[model samples]
Target: MASKPGILTEWPWTRLGSFKYVVLAPWAIHSTYSYLVKDTTQRDLSNFLIFPMLLSRVLHNQIWISVSRYRTAKGNNRIVDKSIEFEQVDRETNWDDQIILSGLLFYLASMYLENGSHLPLWRTDAVIWTILLHTAVIHPFAEHIAYFALFSIPMLSTVFMKNISIISMAGYLTYIDLMNNMGHCNFEHIPKWLFSTFPPLKYLMYTPSYHSLHHTQFRTNYSLFMPFYDYVYGTMDKSSDSLYENSLTRKEEVPDVVHLTHLTTPESIYHLRIGFAHLASEPHKSKWYLWLMWPVTLWSMMVTWIYGRTFTAERNVFKHLKLQTWAIPKYNIQYYMKWQTESINRMIEGAILAASDKGVKVLSLGLLNQEEGLNSSGELFLRKHPQLKVKLVDGSSLAVAIVLNSIPKTSQVVLRGKLSKIACSIALALCQGGVKVYTMREDEHKKLKAMVSNEAGHNLILSQYGTPKIWLVGDGLSEDEQKKAPKGTLFIPFSKFPPKKDRKDCLYNSTPAMLTPKHLENVDSCENWLPRRVMSAWRIAGILHAMEEWNMHECGNMMFGIEKIWKASLENGFRPLTTSVDPKPN
Candidate 1:
């Protein structure tokens, strides 16, 4: 006697076994409605086809399974082997499965609508079936597709199949399947809003974030069509939204290490520690007041004093081709400020040590870690820790790359800061790219003009007379300076305050906080998640640039120079700020 085939071995075709009844039930109802109410002459012979289809479906599945097993034994079918391996890891219904499931439900609904018109009872049954099928099957399948494809497919299918009704439901199902496959292949172009839409469509349709939870640790989000089922059944996972947002915006291309520090203020730290204490004491049942309890605060403070040294949290390894992250923890913001250089250096050293220990290739500095000036350029850290082989990235190049990339090439870019080495480097790069560059810093203007004059003596007229759109880059613009900018002037903020609401047409926040997981998670709480997304894009671009160099030379030092770094940043996806001014004027 042979052993029975497990559900894992059967899959898609096996699904048909249970699903055939779903198809048959609708068909049976329609057949009865047609025979008794619609007309005696009109009989639904389609209902009888269910038994044969089921038998055929089983045979089809068994054949495929046998073939797959045979091919695996012979080692000639990599696709089947890979599918098996994938099943072991994921074990979830993929795009194809979703398509079949959605299609069956659509087909069932179409039958019900087509037959139930004559009887009031049958009409009610049709409505109930439609709701049940949508809630139980279509919604969950749509969600699965959304999470995997980032909400691109279902949105597209909805638009493409807008005119499709019960009469053309088959065509609609086919369109959805086609669009889903296409979206899965090219999901990067899908708009971010599709993923971040409020009241998340996980239950009604699908949401990337909601679906992402199903892929990750939580498996309770089992409702396919609408989250209502999950909520009603108490199977809804609360953290799905945050996890999904993190998946979309976080640097998934490069191996990223999150350098986290405690909140600076003693009061804040006390509160945070107390919160942690409460969480520990009550596990998932901790109350809000527990975080403010004096006993909890005292215990937290005592624990911090005893063993709050910088440490490494768990190395978060993502599944399905996602980046691996090592979360490096440090003291609060105020601790570094109070101790100054020594504390900062210790934190930097700890990050490096932890990263090196975990075999992390690149170490990303946390917020304000670049401040206090210890390893702002990573030159100091490299010099101090010669033995450590990890590359130190302050995320400045990536940040600058993102700002330049966001500004349209047609816009005239103004570098407003005093001509520091970094600013000069940026200005020079812009000039070389042939951007019509301007500057508020007179000294830097003179230097840039001289450099431009020296580089393009004859081409100077091109820059002088070009009709370039003006832009302003600074910490923040003064009220007087704000008046100087044209109505549509774009403001790119570096370190200074953000532009006033009415001051600029658009403001780009290139701050490091935009890229932090904490900020990305709180996207719903703010007016926009664009800044955080930009940060994430920049971080990914920088990491990719580093990855390419590291892969070739086993180190990212190749991008140490300003020119090399700038060029690599451009290649990694940041569009060049400067365009070749047509010396021959139009």
Candidate 2:
């Protein structure tokens, strides 16, 4: 809300007509770009002009207004009208459109810069450095802020489809030209080529794919330069179907700060739960001290808000951050699966109990260690009942192992696919022996959902034995991770879990779940426990001596740092590596 005099509030179209006053863009940019490619006599001035215009627009009121709207919505002014129904649109367009715009803008701006002509060695070097710094530091930060502001408005589109052809066409053409200019013909680092490749692309602008999802689904996809934007802002801002369609409509009012909600689809909720857990693990001040740290708190909050808002405002900011250029080669989904599974084991039984309405069989994969079962005691109780059957699989293949262990003593099995296929081979062998076919994995639930929409019959093929239901049987794993389990699988996450018994269930069952040599060491080693006291004595002596040296100069607030160090020493279980005061000669 800017209250400009003579503004047309009721008639939107009357205000839109004001765009006619905008001067036509200069023709020199196109001429320069065309002339550079076709004629050597023409100076390469495309980048020098284009980049400035884009930057200028960023400084303009329209962009700032968009940024303010985003901040207001994300901050204290956000309103949620649950009655507003919107169709599912691809939010991914936010990323796609941003990259396209940045590419055009960057080239135009670069042309106007001094880099357009060859000069003396030192002068040329200075110009190149200037361009690099401008492209990297100034451009990425500014773009990230602006784009965040623009995308913060969570408006769902009437059309559910994406303009992929436009995106793909623009992406390939622009990226190829960009890659060529960066001095590399391919996607690798080589000499001067290394700087110009993917990293620069990501540093300069986001890829089209990233923003397209934002447009398609407005609420969840707010980040500009990095996916880290949402994490920093305390919002689970990522691409999701619910945010694009049903999320805002179902909720009656928008929150000042995004509230933790169980119904925020599966992915967003998982991020919140797991992220909060991680935050809890980190060292933080007591509630009272934290509340007292008003300046620091305000600074942190403002930074998050500004960072998130910038990305939403400037769609091309993602490209400027070099998100598209850098390749995360080893982003394995399976690695995450294994990690989550292990963490879940700490409270598996409880998760199972939470998920099941009646006693049910649990076919645990690998080893169902005692601690894991104990952590998930509710599931354990259900297992003890006569109606429930608990199975354990100890096979090489994870999928095969979990299934084999879960099957009841006697059950019929069906087999499909060729004999050579792993699923088929295991199914046939197990079927002959009257064992039911089953699939197992951390993502079993997600697979089941995808199975629903797949018209190719592949989904039905996987679901022949039915989707595996997951009672997390543990508190550590996130709801999203649980949901991602095979489709038709049920998630028994601790938070927002269905009620059981009269007492409320604990969100985290942190009852000394893991027992190993580490736990034994904790109990047996007096030396480990004594180190904190020894360290505290040393720290106190050191501070006393330092204060004396400074003649009481360090007395005010200086002791706080030492106090923090002392507390950290105790919390981390610090200990001396050697038993002796001094090492003996070897």
| Candidate 1: worst-modelled 10 consecutive residues by lDDT | 519-528
State model 2's lDDT. Answer: 0.28
TM-score of candidate 2 versus the correct structure, residues matched by position: 0.19
The local distance difference test score of each candidate is 0.41, 0.28
The model with the greatest TM-score is 1
Shift in Å, residue 5, candidate 1: 37
lDDT of candidate 2 at residue 340, scale 0 to 100: 38
Error of 2 at 199 (Å): 42
Each model's TM-score, in the order given?
0.40, 0.19
